[model samples]
Target: MSRPQHFGWFLARGFGPQGWGYPSLDWDYDWTRPEIYQEAARTLEQAGFDLVIIEDAPSLGSADTIDLRVRHAFGGPKHDPLLLAPYLFQATRHLGVVPTVNPAAYLPYTAARQFSTLQHLSGHRLGLNVVTDTGSARHFSDSAQLGHDAAYDRAEEWLTGIRSLWRSWEEGTLVRDPDTGVFADGSKLQPVRHRGAHFAFDGPLNAIPFTDGEPAIVSPGGSGRGLGFAGAHSDVQLALAPLDEASVRAYRAKIQDAAIAAGRSPADIKILFAIQPVITSSAEEADRIVAASAHPDDAALVQIARKQSSDLETDLTSLDLDRPLDITIFGDHVSRGSIQRLIGDRGEDVPLRAHLTALARTGRITDRSGFVGTAEELADLIEELGDWGNDGVLLWGDFHPVTLHRTLDELVPVLRRRGILRREYDEGGLQANLRAF
Candidate 1:
């Protein structure tokens, strides 16, 4: 038997091209329009998913690398996810739309008012996936570029300010007396004056309060500082870890410990691991796909190189394939951890082609190991996570109808049969759905 768990989808490509360069493009869905994502949101809501988190990185690569960023469509060319959230909300009643928002891009007071308005509009189903990427600071006039930990600090301060604004309306502030035609009691509204190292704002946000519950907070950071911020403030922690039991336990323990250290209950935070499982029709097909990736041809290698170039903001496509990359190729701005992950078990002496080749290969989901598998096999991995006391898994993919159906069509039945996925949503909304199990 398996315990029921919360599930979500991560719009891995943000609001960018939904099916560009992929076979899904043949479906001819206009990625620029809202219909593609609205349909996807309905599919997820009908499938009993609690939320869909839209990932965003506000900047194109640095000035010198804009071509690398948009050429392959690996990054950039994204519209604002916050603006897209309302369409998603209008599409589904229970599905939470959590768009990635950076403190650097939005002012505290404006964000507070906008988010609160959406919360009420969505019946408390709106959520913000707070990120602290400083790469986009250059785009905003008032934004200051900060180091990693400092960026987290600013985000913490920024959230603290927004929440303060959300709580500005007192318990008895709304006294709608039809007889007197009085809508609100002005004296009951509290003045919110906040002055923090990163932000200063005054708000008794004009937006009405959320009746179900305030929009649930979501965070996606794996560093210690990131964990601390999430533990202290986030309702859902977008986690990443090895799928095995012990690693799952350890990663969960870190989140639990962080919450406890912050005087917060571990139960208050739901840790949903991020996974991109390639669902195959059968185990043999999974094996065949995995084997075919081992010796990636020139096209495959270049594709990987283009993606890496976008991520590192340094061109890798023109590099000599036979030679090891220069250690200095990455700039001071690129994340060390990201570079290390891309390097992946390679010494400095390893050839650039060898590194990209390794990335092209993937693994199976057998023995609770990897993410490539059949739908039934993927269900087993999810059930095992539930057994390990995991909250759930967030399926990472583009928000396209074809992509959504491809992943969920076969897998949803398997999960539903095993009692791993919910058949229907509970009353209130997304918050209610998250708290249902």
Candidate 2:
């Protein structure tokens, strides 16, 4: 028997427009209002998902890149996901709402107070996907402008300050005596002052302390510094790697090593691999999708190019199909990982068309490496992960009801019947839900 695995949804499109490029936007739900997301949140809870992670990129880059970011709605024009969390909390009782939050965007003092209030408000289901993005530092006048690893340095300091603020009130400090009408012991409030290399703050936050644990911390970085930060502080590591049994076990060991170095047990952090599987109704449909990808025409290649253009911060639509791509076209800030991911195994010497064509080629799920598959096939991969002692998966998609149901409608029942998906949410909210397994 396979042990159950935790599951979450990654709202890759953020709190902005949902299904902008897809035909499902015609579903006619207003993305601006809260109703669409609320409906999605309720659907996720019913499906036994533990959480939904909202992805956000707070900047549109320089004047040259604004069109690339917003023209296709790939990166920018997103509202604050932190603000959207409350509406999600209102819609569901158990699903954890982890909104992307940048240390560069929010002051430590302010973030702590706001996060603390939300944690208590939601009964501790609130979580912060702490990001160390330095591109948007200009938006906040006081924000530090740091380099790659330095950003992690500041985030470490920032997280330290936030936790200091969270623990301002001593344990047993809040004593509610109805007879005396005393809600808290003023004497138990500890002095909270943080003076660090990146941040300085004084706190004894006005927000009440949580009776359960504090809001969970999540990190999505894959670098050495990123892994260290996750090991030291995060309750959830939004991990990414190949999903093979060997790769999964190796990745788990790396995280365990990092945790051990941080004086924490390997189990202190849950490793939820980020997966985006293409689910199909049957083996025939899955094969059809893969077959269509083998030789994508100009129109299909252009569609893939359009999506890549938005992410790379450079347009690929105009590039000559038969000629090699000029590496110079990408800006300094574009993630090399994203560009490499686009090109995949195809070398840089190859023509732009070859790279795009390789991307368009889809493989069968029976390969255990590619994503296209039926619900039963997807479950097989998931069960294999559990058998390897892997934690779970975080499914990536738009936070819209249509996209969600289309993916989960067939998948959830199969997982539940296999005894993999959670049957009921554990008590004490998100943190408890995570540790429950």
Candidate 3:
């Protein structure tokens, strides 16, 4: 009613680790050191974080690829996100655990059962992040990644099947009737014999459906097809928008429009932007931390920019920071298609190198749109974000555990005191907490 709490919580792995920072080999982490996942879960639990996102990627990209190698420590080794979930859930009573899973890699029947089992175990503190493949289906030697629109079609079918499995046995369907030695009432159990172009599954899942029901779906698809798929099925559409105000507003408009076109409530979809908060007792100290943590390598900077804007291919050394960027050098590899389209529309003729450097500088230093200040100042920045139509921030870690802790300990309380954030968590899973909001 009072603008239903706008922001929600989400965290990822590798954000804040005591063991490693940029330029260090990612695998070099002292595994013996306290794991970031555990620490972050505890931190979020104490801070009333609504959800933690467990990223799903089969293997790290090779160090040669610009996008993956730099930010991820030149192709870092990893742990299974799902494997970390139970501990995370157990460690934190109220936080939701959203694990990213590529449906193409695993069968729906198997995934449905696994999610259902987890929901039962975690007391419905589970959620799914459905990501269709990026481009190629090389991840699957058996089957190719579904085509653009087709992938969503498959996702819709896949979601339907999963829900069917969850709802197969209604309440009181399994009656312990001893009079005639009949153990159950079989009428409510419906076999979900779902068969489609991309997937096929028969009957109910192996596991008993959770008394709390199936996990809600969160989709991060901003691609046209992906957005449509999310609008049709997802409980929360996790969106990543640029730092610029115009960019953020435009993306919000587009996603909400897509949601409306799909006959879904635009309010049901929440927009989340990546934030790297560097907080200190004073604004100047926060700035110093940001400056100290800057990624010195220009190549790495260019690579990071390339991830969001795929078109820029200029060497960072050649850029003049004070000028607008030119577009012709991008040639064919247009990045994050939507952002590129925006740039193309603007028709600014600055050098490509300058453009990349500017983007790199922004991303490297102020992940939170330069929200470095005292707790009160940081709260002001978050409230500003809210005023602009965004629901919340998805914080990215700058150096390691310190960055995450600083925000939670210093800034989160400020927001809570302002009547913007929850003072105490509602008792339940991620979906329950969100629905309450």
User: What lDDT does each candidate get?
Assistant: 0.87, 0.86, 0.61
Per-residue error at 435 for model 3, in Å? 0.9
Error of 2 at 183 (Å): 2.7
TM-score of 2: 0.95
**TM-scores for every predicted model:** 0.95, 0.95, 0.78
How far residue 98's Cα lies from its native spot in candidate 3, in Å, is 0.8
In terms of lDDT, model 1 sits at 0.87
- Between prediction 2 and prediction 3, the one with superior TM-score is 2
Model 3: how large is the Cα RMSD against the reference? 5.2
Candidate 3's TM-score reads: 0.78
Point out where model 2 deviates above 4 Å.
142-144, 325-332, 345-347
Backbone clash count for every predicted candidate, in the order shown: 0, 0, 6
What does candidate 2's lDDT look like per residue over 166-191, in tens digits? 88888888888899999999898978
> How do the candidates rank by lDDT, highest first?
1, 2, 3
